[model samples]
Target: MSITNRYLNQLGPQLTERDLAIIRDVGRFKLMSGGQLERLYFADCSDTSRARNRQAVLRRLTGHRVLARVGQRRVGGAQRGSASYLYTLDVAGQHLAQSTSSRPRRPYSWYEPTVAHFLAVAELYVTLTEAARGGRFTVLDFQAEPYCWRSFGHRTLKPDAFVQLGVVHPDGRRRKGSFFIEVDRANQYGAKIETKLPQYLAYYQHHRQTWPDQSFPRVVFLAPHEQRVSYLRRLVAERPEAQRLFTVGLLDELVAVTLDR
Candidate 1:
């Protein structure tokens, strides 16, 4: 955690603007997939060119130890490839990033479930930004975990992210939406998720000074697929009180739910 300004200065000369952004973003998300990086940094390129350019830069960064790859994810039983990599900051990268957050935020220490869950949250962040780019709404604010976490009564409700979106209605009135997002990769048991519902209900019903706004923000559960969505919907349905505020959907449906599209 201790580094001279000269050491930090030295990193800047060896990296590009894009390189620094990548380091900081990986630090921000705690973990990221290569595809997520390409979408954020190389969207202007053709699909083929983007993959080639992304891999080229990522390879060089790994060689420099400016970035580190954790593990490969198998896709539909396919073998590991560059796209399957999940990246975190290396030693040099940690110094460059100057971050000390996440689950220790150290390289090579994360379990596979931890990596997959964080990556899904990272993907949702990307999806929101891409949606805002379409001009229907503007991204007012977005906060990832710890920052997004809310504590009420005796317990804490940790959401993946907290989001605010600004929209201009046909009547020329501006409206803003606040939401708590929970991304599910199908990693937890149904019982575990069921426990989360009550925490949110308590957070909403209580008039705690900790709650950000007067009106309660909609709580969204984004699952990996429709089947997961159906299961979650059934669970939420069991709690008649939750039906009004809680909505369940596939992760890809995030923008539609948030942006009201």
Candidate 2:
């Protein structure tokens, strides 16, 4: 039987809105951690309550075979205690949402190496969601992975994610900001990172007319550590045009500065 059929047979009509929301988020991000879900879905509660509530919900979903654990331990953050399980929509979970098609399942081993990359992307999404909730800014639009890709004639610019932000000023005026996020894990050579800059520049130059009133989305590079962040900053500084078009910082710093501006 297909995953959807199996889930229906086992769980019957027990699914809830929260359950479906979890499935939708997992399907959308391709991967998410328990902590990210808590922030996105359960932020109103105290941290202790949030942690307890999130764990309970995740356990029930996993037990029902709706969500599959992708990693043995959490990939990001410095929180104490056992790490959160990284999650992806199970076969049954995907069928609950649109735009997701069934595909052959990969062995569990395949996800281990890519968990960090997925977590990095998830972290950015979680941060933005939190910022929106705080009322500092509103997330006008967010697109991940393939959805965030854009074609410019012969070339394609695939940002890790694209976000449209509406920043609320002290006087209560909201200004629009758009950005393309690049989550660098320091896995690529410095030269490779340097090479990617020109493609962004080209995309901005070619697409200016498309968004005449709005500036080209600034490219924000979220580096894993300070050294990588510094290196990227130096490289961006060398090119005057790039200096204006790009911003680089460690994840925590970016979260504070980007949304606050």
Candidate 3:
């Protein structure tokens, strides 16, 4: 038996299928907030029931040392009161997940500089999950940075994420929506962002040369606000090829479009 199975045997039978699923998601996403977990896992339950069940499961997992809470509580308005908790997989959780996964678990740290990037990616993931739940789209696959790296002989393209979406049509047909996401935090200059576009183009060209029958995924650049989106749009317009292979949108706009459509 694997070490994880042995640990579970010693811990008795407190864990449930739902608990294991939670651990897998935390392991995959690196970090997830309590609210995200509740929505993703217990969406079918009533609000009160979902909240109660989610908290109970989280508490149990934490108690078993399978998950650890990181990040400080957020103190703010009525919508987000001070009880928020960010959960990440602990050692036992990692072993359990890694045993089945082809890729090994990557290390994560909750330090200042990295926190914003992690949270942004998590927010995007949760938004996509919500869209899937609403029947607007089905998330065929989601690969984070570790698995999102692509090598093109002389160069490498590491997207923040790679998502394969099945968009639902009104006629009941599903269309494929593949995208490589580049998330920006409003810290980088427009020039810096523009420079990255050519790399995507090169990658697309290389992919087309290798597999002429396959369609290349669009490169979706998500920024903090509309102004940034507009700036990126102008940059995209500067290159006709980019207009075909790239898209720019505000984070809220992207989520809204996905959910509403």
Index of the highest-TM-score prediction: 3
lDDT of 3 by residue, 160-202 (tens): 8898888878999878878888887778522367678888989
- On lDDT, the candidate that comes out on top is 1
Instruction: Score residue 161 of candidate 1 by CA lDDT.
Output: 85
lDDT tens digits, residues 1-261, model 2?
Answer: 445565575664687777776776677677777778887888878967877777778888877667887645645566422236777877566555543334322322334556676667778878888767778788888787677889988988878889888888889987888889888878843225677799899998888867767568888888879899889999998889888888887878766657644
- For candidate 1, list the clashing residue pairs, or say none: none
Tens-place lDDT per residue, model 1, 1-261, is: 444566667656889889988887787778898878988888889966887888899998887777788875547533135566888888778877754334334444677557767777788878877777777788898787667988776878888889888987777888999999888767763336778898888887774456556778889898888888999999999999889888888887898877662
lDDT of candidates 1 onward, in order: 0.78, 0.74, 0.76
Instruction: Order the candidate numbers by lDDT, best to worst.
Output: 1, 3, 2
Worst 10 residues of 1 by lDDT: 99-108
lDDT for position 203 in model 1 = 81
RMSDs, each prediction?
3.7, 3.8, 3.3
Candidate 2 accuracy as TM-score: 0.83
